[model samples]
Target: MHIELSRNSSVKLYLQIAKTLADRIQSGLLPQGTKLPSVRHLSSLLSVSPVTVSKAYAELESIHLVVCTQGKGCYVAEPSVSLHREEALDLSWQMSLIDYLPRAQLWRNFNHSRQVPYSFHIAAVQPELLPTREIINDTRRLSSEDPDAMAVYGTFEGDVELREVCAVHLSERGIRTEAEHLLVTSGAQQGIDLVARTFVGPGDVVYMEAPTYTGAIDVFTSRGAKVVMIPMDEQGMRMDILTRLRDTHPPKLIYTIPTFHNPTGITLTTVRRMQLLDLAQSYHCLIVEDDPFSDLYYKTKPPLPIKAHDLSGHVIYIKSFSKTVAPGCRIACVVATGSVLDRLVAAKSTTDLGSPLLTQKALLPFIRHRLDNHLVSLRDQMQDRLTTALHTLQRFAPAEVTWQAPEGGLNIWIKLPPAVDIAELGRLADREGISFLPGGVCYAGGMESNHIRISFSYTAKDTLEAGLRKLCRLLGELLDRSVIMERRPIL
Candidate 1:
């Protein structure tokens, strides 16, 4: 039998040797008739004295686990084994306590993937715009040059070379950061989870805009934190209300999607951005900025990121390239310093060790090559798509419905009449072969129900107007009725 032992274990060497062999016997790995080695042979194999091997054999015999013949070797005995399991358990009750992201009917019908044949529910680059051939070439090239890219485990913080490159890229965007302060994450989703798990606790307050990313709401709430909703204005988070909240209860963290805010597509103004930084520092609250759309801007240049003005590391900035860069790459980075950075890295370690090194290395060269030329084409095409979608909405939408043309982002948030039934609207829209994100899921308290988020990034150019017309028709029908009925009973 092949055996390995730990000298540092508290158990005696003979007992350790006996347990290992006994386990193999009970497991049926060592068959009933199988012969163990001679005492001297086993002693030499285990690098122990013959007396230890004899004692181990004697222990197995005393337990009736093995048969020792006078001249021959010891053999495994037939084992009567029993494994206990709870076939009918209250697992649901236990899971209800910690389960986040349960599959609901809304998402079951419309997911991030292309499960639905016709969809506007997800935001991603069109297939034509994605650098498929280039990505393949880069992956093949990396595999040939550095086999370790796939063979070895990446550093806990992720690839050093990739981090250096990311540092330079962030510097160009007005965020003066170094490689040491950044931890590469699977995507912005994990970045949010890491910050939430590392810093937030049960009953701690986490302030976020009323209508923000649904994933953030789910993460914080599932962890038992009290997620307080801050109101949002045209510019961004309402600073006046934020200041009042600060005076009463200082939040553990303030989560924001500052530039091209999710669902709403509203970018925070430069003045608001500065004010947010000051408030965060004064309230002793850390800002978790989830930024995935700043690079996807259209006409006007978006204001500097809230992290750009952070002089004292009050902000943990998360930027994802999964939507803008190749979707399959699943790449993003987190920028923070001090204890926040240290804890986030530790949290990330428990999440997946680190994002796959092969993905990081494979995309590194492609990113370097695409910075100028490929990005320009990408931006131009997305801008055209957004323009087409906006025109379509304007042409068909009724006078009462309104939407803000975002500075740069993939989504256009449509505001329905407050009385309109959003759930019924979603069901009808699904029947029409179009899917979009209902705004109710975006709220922490899940009470808001007057908005829907549609993406212009994934649908084809030719199908854009037709899909939008269908949505407008449905909305027009829903709004025409004096009282649109809600799917659930009014409380």
Candidate 2:
């Protein structure tokens, strides 16, 4: 019987109180013919005027939602004869509509197989490099010394100091952005969601890099937009196809991860970057550049982000501190050049007032004290693991199993022989002690059956070797079974 009322809401106070009680009755929490509290008692409990409670009860009785007798206190009605079956049917239909509105696809089939022990998730954030001790100390300091900052709701555009620090970091990467152009969000996922909600809508054409980040695909597709998949090669998205497509079907937005792309682990070439910018400028399509792994370069020098070449104010750049700093901290920023920033701000304001201010404040110390040095250390450590993983994979894998060594990034894209089925192989690997992402999840139309993405980021040297060996063994078994099945006479 807890009724929390908001004084600021547009709904009348009495109606709000009535609705709360009606909801309890409808939900069966208040059984049929249950006695409700007296007006004075409810008023005192809710800290509201008795007149308001009296009006609410009168309205409920008038609607036959509750019955009031001469002597007995107001009791929940056992559905009066006036209530129609069609009304209940209509309510059920409305509830079904809300339930099936295609919200965030938070649950997936892969999560159900957690019963298998030794499950290695290739798409997880690397935990070994997370700044745990530093973040814990900063959290303690912020909670104790700056209690007011944590207690109050943050600004719609997030903390100004954090935006200033993010602006400086972007400047170093050749993206000329200011604090005003930046908007902090819960994570890069929320940043992408805000961008999608603000710009594209139903029937809008949104161009996505083929085999792009599955999470982005889910967000855009769930919004009822027509997702047009642009093909990608080793250097990244095929610009020629995109240019032709842009000429024919103008897209509302072009989403890409130009630097150290996920799954493929390929950086976009300078020529393609310039072409993309030109296409975006010529056609009126917005470009969303998701650059989360740009700072984790191992062998080659990091290339400038797509934002650096954007002479026009069409590209929206997004970056996350989750991968570089700590995932639990969940801090990300989006920089849009023109009116896109305003729309994103409005959408974000409605979603949440702002990201956690204390988390933003804690990150200031990392940017000031030891961000560069931490990246350097991480690079060195990852380089060692990458080299070891490459050598071990090469030694254990069969000749038919081919992969390219990415100059930088956390994972490797492996192309198995045509006859092998990676989806089935993933299940078989799950039964064993190893796991990897099937390539079908990355593609748009459920293609690419013989490909897999293997991450060597959080995996230790011994585990990396052991996992590769186990995977190769499974591949061999699959190939042998395929050969045997092919050789057998057809029934």
Worst 10 residues of 2 by lDDT: 95-104
lDDT of 1 by residue, 346-453 (tens): 998888998899999987887666755776778899999899999999899887889999878889998888756787887898788888888777776435568888
Best by TM-score: 2
Could you say which candidate leads in lDDT? 1
What is each predicted model's overall lDDT from 0 to 1?
0.80, 0.78
lDDT tens per residue, model 2, 244-284: 88766788899998888887888999989888888888887
Off by over 4 Å in 1: 1-110, 483-491
Q: Stretches of candidate 2 above 4 Å error?
A: 1-106, 109-120
Clashes of 1: 0
